[model samples]
Target: MTQPHLLYVAWGYPPCRGGGVYRALATANEFARSGWRVTVLTAGRDTFEQYTGTDPSLESQIDPSIDVVRVPFEWPAQDADIRTYSWLRAHLPQVWHRWRAALDTVTFPERGYGPWRAPLERAARRIQETDPVDLVLATANPYVTFAAADALFEEGVPYVLDYRDAWTLDVFSGVTLASHRSRVGRWEDRLIARAREIWFVNAPIRDWHADRYRVHADRMHVVANGWDPELLGGDEPGTETRGAAVSPMTVGDGDRSHPRFGYLGTMTRMVPLAALIDGWELAKRRGSLPPHATLSLAGYLGYFAVPDPEMLATIERGRAIGVSYDGPVPKQDVGDYYSRVDVLVLALGAGRYVTSGKVFEYLATGKPIVSVHDARSAATSVLDGHPLWTATESIDASAIAAALGRGWQLSQTADATQRDAARAYADRFRRDRQLAPRLRVLRDVATTPSESRG
Candidate 1:
C-alpha cells in the first residue's frame, strides 16, 4: 500500500518560538509517526527571526521524514525598522496605520496576516501539483492558513481546522469579535462550514462555537493541549527528573527558607504582570511568604521579536521586590529552568475561555503550581484535582498573595506521593495520548480512496 500524504498549513511552525509552534510541530510529527507522508507549508525563517523571535533548537525535533516548505510571509505591521516606513507613515503614524489596516483586510478579513494568504495559497497549489495531497490540517492565529486549506477544499480536498484559540470570540473578554455580516465572520463561517472537523484547545471555546453554529456542533471537538514528551517527558542523561526527588530548596542552594518561584512560557500582554508584581510584594511583606523569596521569570518578554517596552519596564521595576526576569529559554533547556524553581507561577489574563498551553507542561513537571487567573477560567477544570495546585479566589493582589504563600508552602511540604500524583494526573494529557483518538479517525480517511474521500 502506498503511503498517504498529509499537507499541514501552519503560520507558527518550528523555530517560531511560542506555545502554538509546539502544537503545530507535534501535530505534523504525530501524523508522520502514524505512517503518513507529511509536508508542512509555513512562513519563511525570516518571519520568525524578524518579527516573532525564534528558538532554532525546535527545528531538530521535526520528523526527518517530513518535507517542510517555507514561503515568503511579509508582516508590514510588525516591521519596526524606521527606514522602511513611507513619508506619511513617519509623519502621521496613526493615519498611516489606518490606511494600512484597511488595505490589509481587503484581501482577507484578518489584518496582520491577511496578506500572507496569497503566498500560502500559491504554496498550497504548488504542493498539490507536485504531490497530490490526500488530506490537509491547518492551525491558525494568522487564520490565513485556513484560507489556503479552504482553497484546497473547494477543489474537493478535505481539511481540518485546529484553532489553537478562538478567532471570532474574544477569549479574554468573553465578547463576540465579529458578526456574520462582517468580513471576518463570513470568512470563519465559510472555513468552518467546509472543514471536515474543527478543533479547539478547550471546551469553553468549543461550547461557544457550538452555541453559535448548531449545525457544526457535532463536528466540533476539544483537542486539549498536552506536553510533548520528546521535550519534557523525562530526565536526560546525568540529570534527574524535576520533582522526581522533591527538594524544597532551590537547586544547589541549601536555603530552604526562601523558596524559589518561577514562571515559564511567552510573557504576552495577556499575562497579569502588574498584579503578579503587586501580589508578590504583598505576599512577601504582609502574607506568609518569606521576605526574601524570589520569583524568576524565564521566557521572551512578548510575542514579537521586538519585546513590549511597557512589559519590559514592569519586569524591571519588579526586581526591587525579588521578582526578576531571566529572559527566554530555548525549547531544549526549558527543563533545566523548570528544575531550578521550587514552585511554578501561572499568572494569566482574566478569561473563562482562555486556557494556557503551558499548563500541561507545568503539570508534567510534578511541581506545585500557583494559578493567578480568574477562578472561573476553563483552566480550573484542568487543575481541579491537581494534588499540589494552589489557586486564587480572584485576580486581586490579596488573593494572589495568599495563593503564592500557599504555593511556596506546598513546594516545601508536598510528599513524594503527592509529587508523583501531580505527574500521574498529567499522564492522560500526554501529547501522543491526546492525539491518539483524533489520529484514529484520520487513519480511516487515509485508507479511503483518494477520488471519493474528503
Candidate 2:
C-alpha cells in the first residue's frame, strides 16, 4: 500500500521552541509512522533560531522520512539576533517598524503572524505544484495558516485544521472572543466549516466549537497532547549533570534537602505566577514546606524575543520571595529538570477549556503535582485519577497555599507504591498511545472518497 502524501502547515515546528511545536512535531511524526508521507511547512531556520531560539535535540525526534520546508519570515519585532534586520530597518526606520508591528495585532489577532498570509499562501501553492498533496493539515496560532489551507481548499484540495488553541475563544479569560463577529472570526468560521476535520486539544474547546458551529460538530475532534516516549526514554537521570556548565539553566537535582519544584514551559501572562509566589510565602509562613523548597522556572517569556515587562517584574518579585527565576532551559535538559524536582507546579490561568501541554509532562514525571488553577480547569480531567496531585478549586493565594502545603507533604512521604501508581497513570498518556486512534481516523479520512476531491 502506498502512503498518502500530507502537507502539514505549522508556523512553529522542531527548533521553534514553543509548546505548540511539540504537538506539531509529534503529529507529523505519528502520521508518518502510520504510513503517511508528511511535508512540514514552517518559517525558515534562521528566523526560528534568531527569534524563538532553537532546540537541536528536538530534531532527533522527527521522523527521518518526513520532509520539512522552511520559508523566510522576517518579523522585525522579534529579531533579537541584530543581524536579521537590514541597516535601514534596524537603525534608520526603527520607529516605522515598531509602529507597523503595533498595527499588525489590530490587523490580525496574531502580531507577527498576520503579515505572513501572502508568503504562506505562496509556499502552499508552490508545494502543490511540485508535489500534488493528498491532504493538508494546518495548525493554528497565527490562525493565518488557515489562509493557506483556504487556498488549497479553493484548489479542490482537502485540508484539516489543528487548533492547538482556539482563535476566537479566549481560553484564559473564559470568554467568547470579542472579535467573534469581526472579519477574522468570519474567516475562521468559514474555514472550519469547509475543512475535513477541526482538531482541538481538549473536550471543552471541542464543545465550544461544536456549539458554535452545530452544523460542523461531526467534523470536530479532540486530539490531546501527551508525553513523547522517545525523548523521555533517552533522557539522563540527573538534571544537574545534563546542562552546559555556565548556561543560565537550572533543573530539579533530586536533593531532598533543597528539593526544586520546577515549572518547565513558557512563562506567559496567563500563568498565575502571583498565586505561586503567594503560595511559596504561605508555605514559609506556615513553616510546613521543606527548608530548601525552591521553585525553578525554565522557559521563555513573552512571544519570541519580546519580554513582557509585567511578567518579568513578577518573576523578580518571586525571586525575593524564595522562587528561583532560573532562565530558560533547553529542550534537551527538560528531563533532567523534572528529575531534579521532587514536586512539579502546574500554574495556569483560569479556564475549564485550557488543558496546558505542561500538565502531560508533569504527569509523566511521576512526581507530586501542585496544580495552581481553578479546580474546574480541563487539566483536572487529566489529573483527576492521578494520586500524587493536589489541585485547588480557586487561584486564591490561600487556596494555592493549602494545595502547595499538601503537595509538599506528599513529596516528603509518598511511598514507592504511591509513586509507582502515579507513574502508571502517566503511562496511559504516552503520546503514541493517546494519538493512535486519532491518527487512524485521520488516515481513514485521508483515503475516504469525500477527502479525495473537495
TM-score of each: 0.94, 0.87
Q: What lDDT would candidate 2 get against the real structure?
A: 0.78
Best by TM-score: 1
Predicted candidate 2 versus true structure: per-residue lDDT over 177-231, tens digit per residue: 7455877677887888899888899999999889988999998888889877556
Global CA lDDT of candidate 1, please?
0.85
Name the weakest run of 10 consecutive residues (lDDT summed) in model 1: 243-252
Q: What Cα-based lDDT does every candidate model obtain? A: 0.85, 0.78
lDDT of 1 by residue, 1-454 (tens): 7888899999898889967999998889888888899999998998899988999999998999999999898878778899999999999999999999988887898888888888889899999998898889999887989998988887678889999789989999999999998888888899888888899999999999999999989889999988776686363212344223222222324366778899998888888898899899989888478877899988888787777899989888889878888888999887778878888998888889988888988887888899989888888899999999999888878989999989988887878788878878877777776788988997777678757664
Clash count for each candidate, listed in order shown: 0, 3
- Residue 124, model 2, lDDT: 92
lDDT, candidate 1, at 164: 75
Error of 1 at 366 (Å): 0.5
